[model samples]
Target: MTAFEATFEHEARPISRPLRIALLGYRSDPFVGGQGIYLKFLSKALVELGHQVDVLSGPPYPDLDPRVGLIRIPSLDLFACDSHVKALRWRHLRSYSDTFEWCSMLTGGFSEPYTFSRRVAKYLRSSAKPYDLVHDNQSLGYGLLTLQRRGIPVVTTIHHPIHRDRQLALDAAPNWKFRLLVRRWHSFLRMQEKVVSQLTNVVTVSEQSRQDISGAFGICQSRIDLIHNGIDTQTFTPNSEVAVDPWQLITTASADQPLKGLRFLLQALAQLRPDFPQLKLLVVGKLQPSGTTARLIDKLELASAVRFVSGISTEALVEHYNRSAIAISPSLYEGFGLPAGEAMACGCAVISSDGGALPEVVGDAGMLVPAGDSGQLANGIATLLRDPELRKELGLRGRARVVERFSWQRAAIQFSNYYYRVIANADG
Candidate 1:
């Protein structure tokens, strides 16, 4: 018999008992993107709420809380090495899964999720300890169906939809060839769409994301749950010692991706520079060498005025937030705008685009501009630059807003309840 059908005492516990949760991620590195950040904090929060949380991730493993277990699910990790060809080993050929990954990356295809799922399925079959449920961190891999068949109740959080990013990148591609390459890179959306529809319990960060996921994956709205992501106010709070730089604007974005709207921010900065020569930008992300963003920065003639900082610690990020006069979220879409919320938590004035769930998070605490509008973004920056009193007031209001509505503690409680709901249904 399965664990779910074991002796009554072993199979079912008191409703108050702390759950055993396995959080799955195909690839998670906290500094890489928002998904990694989600895994890091949610695992930490779940553990703090007295649940046993194990994060299963493939290489570039996440920096997780010490108490939360990290089960390193190894992959080819081709992206980490100097060259994909050089990264290949004889052991890789021994496994068809690894061979597929090597071959996929060789041809500009992403095969991590597919191979990672096979690894996860194998591990679950042999794992001595069983879990009450598996909470997926947007992997949406076929392993989830395997888990369900093996009696592991599964729920997943679809953080917006990859299809949205794929479309935005395709639209921004300079030529049909580049668009075809983009299409090939994002072909996993087909699997995600199929998997999302089959899963019974789906959670998303915002109502905006829920609608987008439903539309993008053609899934029913009733299957998705809304869980507002939280900001760590204690760690991201205002540092009075770090004086705000008057002319420096800050934003966190994925440098080359069209969905981030970083290109538009660069355009807005170029527009503002002549009027405000001292104006500088602190970009909290990598500026890939020889990439579109790098070329655009040179074209805009703002090389000296813009600086990129990546892979900084949370403390360092909080310091950056405190040091800026205004923080901006220029994402074309975000399931939940963590950077804007972090800025607000740091007592910094914010100007965010009404993209995805940003307006929902900013909520009268910050200025809102239309997404992809460089002129409006520039004007919003200028307004904050001219008005110190307004900035101070907004900063105060933003901090208060974070304190009132957002916290990991609250999110953990909600998630624990959600977990029990899924578990209870499975048991019944």
Candidate 2:
């Protein structure tokens, strides 16, 4: 039986009735990334429970539930344009924020998080409605401080701190120049670290993330709350008809960064290819062609065996998971490891590393190996590939695990409960 069945079996007791919620995020795409999916389903789930939801987001805004109003706060994302570096028009230069965004990207600094926070801060200040609570999705900025000062009940969810990204990049840097560039690119982490430490009533995606944030940012663990992220078990269920071609494997790599450990997965594949020439990988994200992941792909010469597809619908991604013989999560670290959870939910025999929260997500249902260990990853994949019965058993167990523990409805209700508690504490 699924976890949902157990959660449903127990009668849910509500401490408070519905209230107005304002969810703040920089971006919200249901499938483009996890944050968007978080906002989309969360808003919908909140609405389903008779709460009024308004998601205020910036560029690459979310496709949200129609019942939940989406407030767009635009930012200057030059890279998102069809044109390259030449795409910047003179008009774009007129805005200070736009100029900052363009110039920062040119110089290798990541300015989106800062700029988006500025935009959102301005928006919240101008809004007419008074929300019972303001829930921020990892955009830890002075803007949240502004909301709190305004006497709005503020709670921010840090999926994971960006400091982890910085540290990972530093570890993977091949030279001093690249290390400097990596540090520059992660300059936003300084702001995030500062903001997170000062923010009261913070929430996180997992217990592992809570510990990581406390260790990385020097924040008090008691100030942070754990709210496990959810997966749509109904949507990601298994399809036996999904044909697995060759020694096929699927994974989701949203970015071509070292942190995702795609390079590690490639190395594992390299070791396996000698014994299994039929091995192929299908990634549910695009390859930048010239980026680090792309370069790694070229170095491995597995370009023909590996495929990347992005911007697909949720159903399409589930189909990709269902069709694969196995799903692998090669991330060096994850706050919640959504790909692991989603793949397990889809009934794909999962081979994940003990990277950050992956073990928490995969649990005892799927195979676990050491993070950054290519040999173990290769062996786990080989084991699943060779054993059909084992794969089926693992996959079935995984789907059941997800159905019991991770669901958007449960997460939303939990958030609702937390919001009331935060408010009660404040009132007290």
Candidate 3:
């Protein structure tokens, strides 16, 4: 661990007050995204620390610990169902927020963050007792401002700005039409940028993210606190008995998205296949069977070698990590690379692209390749696959790094201290 990380871990305060926390998110699904995983583990950790957490979420609500209460604010994008576009009930039209959410998405604008925050503010206004603090998960919007105006102490966790996604997507797009759509999809960043600057206290997943966000969103650096995200080390630990296959490599890919760089990884895999016929890519996401990924696999004639697995238990995921000798994180950008950290925590050697906060997360524990470089990725994976001793050594060191530096207990304590500071500052 770096000296700074070690110091932060050592200085964390373990509080016993059992504070009431209102954790807010626009969307969370335990297995799918980092926000959901953060909510799931953080809420569970807060509960472990003797606090009560109630999650207020929108469409595709998080599957949190049973102890955490869920107040689902229904969205027109129910279950992310594409079919919901045509099946809106008349009663749904009565809800102006729901109608706006549906119309915004249909018109190519992502409106969940704005609509959800409005609903959350409305809910809080009607509740009998206000929460001790309101913790927002990146949905910086006007309603959050309302909460602050009403004297509810609020702290937001900005897991990096959405502008990075827009920039990367614009750079990747072939033409102006796609760029326009990309801008439309991320239209809510304007709301976030305004809201973020006004929010009193903000938490970020890493120092790198905090710095990047401050620069990207033009927010003051002092307003953002760095709370390194955790690895569920016990659940994601090494599986020794699962024999590591020499030619099998694994990665988590959001198949439908371009920013995931799954296409680049697939292209690299295509290059490597002729030289290493036994090689296979095990992707841990639902394959968009009809998307560009499937077409690319067919074009590369790797349809038989690539496998996609989804909805597996944490144990099953760890098992998959163990089955592979090495793991790859090929994201074009990441707020904090959880897949890299999780693979590292599981004792699997990792090769991660130096995208966004990934290098910050890996911190010499694993190999670093330039983002979007298919040749470099192929070389890194090939080297690790050929060198078992190097893989094992890196794997051991990576696991040690996460255990010592990134733990939910540590995050919870740090967050609790920040909670106190925010509350004290508000009162003062």
Over 1-428, each residue of candidate 1 has an lDDT whose tens digit, in order, gives: 21222222232232376999999898899887878888888888888878999999998999988999999999989888899987889977899888988988988888888888888989999999799999988888888888887878898888889888999989999999999999999987788877877887888888789889888988777667877788888898998999789998999988998998998899999999999999999999998999999999999998999999998999999999899999989889988899999999999999999999999999999999999999999999999999999999999999999988888776777778778878888888
Cα lDDT, model 3, residue 284:
95
Give lDDT tens digits, candidate 3, residues 307-413.
99998888899999988888999998888999899999999999999888899888889999999999999998888877889999999999999998889988998
- lDDT rank, highest first? 1, 3, 2
Candidate 1 displacement at residue 169 in angstroms: 0.8
lDDT of 1: 0.88
**Residue 172 lDDT in candidate 3:** 74
List clashing residue pairs in candidate 3. none
lDDT of 3 at 424: 81
For each candidate in turn, the TM-score is 0.95, 0.92, 0.95
Backbone collisions counted per model: 0, 5, 0
- Sequence-dependent TM-score of model 2: 0.92
* 1 versus 2: better lDDT goes to: 1
Least accurate stretch of 10 residues (summed lDDT) in model 2? 1-10
Candidate 1: residue 224 Cα off by (Å): 0.5
lDDT of 2 by residue, 248-367 (tens): 898888656777888888999988998999899998888887788888778888888898888888889888888888999988899999989999998889999898899999999999
Clashing pairs in 2: 2-404, 3-403, 3-404, 4-404, 28-62
